[model samples]
Structure formats: structure tokens, C-alpha cells
Target: MPTEPATYPGYRFPAAVIHHAIWLYHLFSLSLRDIELILAERGVVVSHESIRRWCLRFGTEFAAKLRKRRPRPGDTWHMDEVYLKINGELFYLWRAVDQHGVVLYILVQERRNATAAKRFFKRLLVGLKYKPRKIITDGLRSYGVAQREVLPGVRPRTSRYLNNRAENSHKPTRRRERQMQRFKSPEHAQWFLSAHAMIYGHFRPRRHLMTAGQYRRSRDQALRIWRQETCARVVE
Candidate 1:
């Protein structure tokens, strides 16, 4: 079998290297400068700004491919909204994860009212193209209102404890927030987290349910698909 070479036009670095840098940024709470230093130890001399540019260029493209390749998510979705402070302004980060803890989607909005909730619901329905069987959320009145208007048929369960999965999923975002000293803007936060959530979830399977060998194999398969999506020959 012949493996076609990846042509990352107008870039001198190989596609694998670029994708690896992007992977390092998302898979952990590493900053651009941190990624630069890590790659420096590997004999690849590149500036942090260059890595940031690479992330901006390819992160969304790679994440979209990964999202499309993912299996159908669980029917029971857990949704949550948390406040984010970007530039000292309040922004609401709306997130949804399935019962299996796979991130379904994320949105950054300026409000957390019924209108905002409906918007998130609509966006979710567009991506899923179907209604989830049930949704669990915190005791937010907006969720109840949104469910009635947007998803009239789906049952909604209000529980702060049962929605812990969605809350726990925000931990990674928190870590990244601290690592980056907070996002510069709402757009930047959404753009970065959009890719980060999908890619991060892809590599982090439920290791507790898997044997050591199964965990390793799962991670390896994730890497393989990540490479293909980035049009790279291998994971560097």
C-alpha cells in the first residue's frame, strides 16, 4: 500500500510535527510556551508564537474530522452551564455530555437565560439531527423553560447530583483556563475549547473499565485516527 504524502502548503514543517504541537496543546493544560520548550528538548526549534499559529490554523479542522468520525453518542444527555470570566466579563459556557461521559457539544454565550438555553438546544439539535431520549440538568429554571419550547417531547430531569458528570467535565476547562491565565476573549475561549474538548475526550477513554492492554490499544487507535485526520504520516 502506498501512503500519500501530506502536503501542508506554505508550511516548512511536516504535517506530523504541526499536528503533534496541536495535540500537545489540547491533550494537556500546556501553554504555547510550554509546548515550545517541550519540543525544544526534542531537537525541534520553534517559537511559541509559531505553535500558537499552528493551533489556530489546524485545531478546528482536525477536531471537526474527529467529531464526524466518532460513534453515535448515548441517548441520555446531561447538560450544564458554567460561568466563565474572560477579560473580566461574564460568559456562560454551555456543555452537554452523554451518559457515557462523551462530550456531545459546547457553546460559549453571553447569557444563561431561557433565550440562551434555547439557542444551545437548537444548536445541539442541529448537530445531532435528533432528540435525545432524556436530559438531566441542574435546577436551572432556564433549562426547564428551554425544554418546553425547544424539546417539548424529551423528558427533563432536574437534579444537581445526577448532573455531576457534566460538572466534572468542566474540570479540564478549568485546568486549561488556569494554565493559559484565562482566555483573552470569548471567541478565543470557544475556538480553543471547541477543539480541545473533542480531541481531549478522544484520547481519554474510560480507563477504569478497561484492562491495561485495552487502555493502551484504545489510546493507540485514537492516535491513529488523529494522525489520519491531520493528514499526517504518524504521531510524532
Candidate 2:
């Protein structure tokens, strides 16, 4: 079993219950209500709203911890934008994931224009502090401009097949969106996704490509990261 971080100062629920709810929410695509009911069967009688709060507060933190402890991303990046409908209007989610399929950055915008592209590029580069050797994107002019300004000298490749990795990455988000009906507001969408991306980044293994031993090691590493991030404590 995994241990909770000392920095948590102890939560309302046991670490096991908190961890179980989070894992179910992320791993099985279960909503807060669904997770609550699932736990109820196991003799934990937490409310759906409580589960929701747990996910909102601790999910991203756990994922951030996992990311900090994981291996660095590959030097190649894949960028793409997917349309999200909110209140019958269209919005865009610009995401950048590295060669190893680790999500490096994500931004929710009302448009997919040059300004939006520039903003996304800037956000993506802010924490990286290093340039990628190659960037893959579809034939979007905004991407071209942003790449020129933000990541100049790096090869920006646009082609049908090359950008498939980025396009495929949107599937999980799409599934979750469909399950939830639709995002109520941009803020809600951003908040949920920002947390969701980090959680998704943590437990997802390279199952199709890696061997059993490699996958097991990856899983263990992810768990270790979660423990360290959530358990960090400073002595008084």
C-alpha cells in the first residue's frame, strides 16, 4: 500500500479512501457520484460532493508529484488543438505532449488564432526552459507563426501521418467530455482538465508498446511518485 504525504496534515478521510476515490476517478473514468457509490459498496459512505472535492483538491497535486519524479520528456514535441463546445459556442484546447506521450502543456482558449497559438506556445515553453529538437503539428498557420517566434531554429514538421500522435492523444479527453455531457464554463473546463491531465499523465502506462516488465516498472515508478508528492513533510 502507498503512504500519504506528511504535508497533507492529515485529511478528513483515511489515506486509503482518498487514494481509492482518486484512482477510481482517474483510472475508470468514474464521475464523483459513481466513485461514491462504488466506495459505498466497499463500506465507505462518503458523499459524491465530497469525492468531487477530494479530486479537485488532491488529484492535481498528486499528478504534479508524479510528474516531478518521473523521467524527463523526449526532445520532440507534438502539438494539436481540439474543439470543445461550451454553451453551444465553440472553444479550443491547445495541447502539447512530448514524444513519450507525456503532456507538457495545455491551454483552453476561445479561438484558435495566432494570438491563441502564441499564448499556448509561450505557456508550453515557460516551464520547459529548453527547446525541443522537433515540433509536430497539423497544417495550422497559427502553429507555424508561433513556432517561428517561440521555438525558432527547431524543425516544425506538418504532415498527416506525423501529427497522428497528437491527434490520438485527444481521445481520452473526448471520452471524458462526452461522459460529462459538456463543460459548463471555460473556467470549469480548464480547472478540470488541468487536474485531469496531470492525473492522466501519471498512471497511464505504455501498454501497447512496452514489455510486461517495462510496464510494471513504469507503474511502480508512478506510484512512488504519487507517494513522494503527497507525502512530503517539513519537520517543525
Candidate 3:
């Protein structure tokens, strides 16, 4: 009920079409042109550049609205960082997820030192609105320093195997990275990932734990919610 209030004004294509195009691109390892071709197969006949524009403009808005409908994250958090090579330059991609494997946030920064770690912790606190009861991560000394200064009183579990959830969250991103031929720069990576992480996560609900019937019901529910979130006028 918090989303779905948006209405398409001057857009030529219906909001349904635009939302579906953005969905295809973010939920899978598809490029803009890949989405263009898929839509063409359905007789939509739109250019790749137009789809790109739609995603660039509407994707973030849609993700923000959908997040309003999400459940509160688990109290146990997992944190990890990966090395990203963009434009032949090295950068760190910081990410956090709840114990349930729900992505909390993503950040790109130049350093993995204590300063950068503190910035990431602050961003998470602002977005999540509460400190986690416990955080699991590797024995990165930067996390130790940041936890002392930023997340005081939160329990920190430093181990090699405890944070597999956060580490595995980067797999889909690696596939998308190769497909897009790597991001043009840090801004580009963050822009795409900011939307991709949320939108893609919405329809994905840990299928391995569900029966086929359960998965279908979950997916149907997600799509119904998507229609409610992105469509200016509900379809059928």
C-alpha cells in the first residue's frame, strides 16, 4: 500500500512495458541490447538505447518504492569486500547482508582502510535505522577499528567461514560485470548495482528451500507486488 502511487505522465510506452524491460535487464545477465531483443520477440519493438534510458531513470525509483514493502532485516549482519577493476583502476566494493542473506546496502570506495570502513558503517546505520546485534566478518583489522569507533557495543565475530553469505552475494554481480564488460567507472557501477541489487533481490526468494508450489506462490506474489509498485494503472 505504500508504493504503486506513481503515474506515468508523458511516457510514450505504458508503465507496464517500461517496468518489465527494466526487470529483465536487472534480474538476469542481460545487456540493454539483450533486453531490446527480448522485448522485440514479444513484438514490443523498442530500441536498446531507449530501454537503457528507461532503466537509468526508473530503476532506482522503482527499487526505492519496493524496499518500503520489505520486511525488517535480521539482527545478525554479514559484511564483506571485493576488489573491483574499473577502467584499469583498482577500487573496493563493500557490501553488507543480513543473516537471512538479504542485501542491506552496497558501497564503492577507493580504500579499504579504517576510514572507508567507518564511512560504510555510518551509511548502514543511516539506512537500517538500527545497529545490528552482531556482525560477522573476516579478521580485517579495519573492521575492528571501525567497529570500535562507529558500531560500539555491537558484537563482532571475526572468522574465516562465518561470512559466506556476504561473500557469495558477489557472484551474481561478477556475472553481470563480465556481461556489461565491466563498469565504466565507480559511479556507473554503483548506479547500476544500487538498483540491480534491490530489484533483483525482490523476485529471488531462496528457491532452494521451497517446494515448486511454494516457489510459484512466492513468485506470483512478488509479481503482483511488482505490478502494484511500478504500474501507474494496475493491469488486469
The top-ranked prediction according to lDDT is: 1
Expressed as tens digits, the lDDT of each residue in 1-236 for candidate 1 is: 66544548788787767889999999987878999999999998999999999999999998999999999988899999999999899999999999989998899999999999999998888866677899999989999999999999999999989999999999999999988889999999999999999999999999999999999999999999987788844322
| Candidate 3 Cα misplacement greater than 4 A, ranges | 1-7, 233-236
lDDT per prediction? 0.91, 0.81, 0.89
Model 2 lDDT on a 0 to 1 scale: 0.81
- Model 1 clash pairs are none
C-alpha lDDT of candidate 3 relative to the true structure: 0.89
TM-score between model 2 and native? 0.90
lDDT of 3 at 153: 96
lDDT measured at residue 230 in model 1 versus the true structure, 0 to 100: 83
Candidate order (lDDT)? 1, 3, 2
Worst 10 residues of 2 by lDDT: 3-12
Backbone clash numbers for all candidates listed: 0, 3, 0
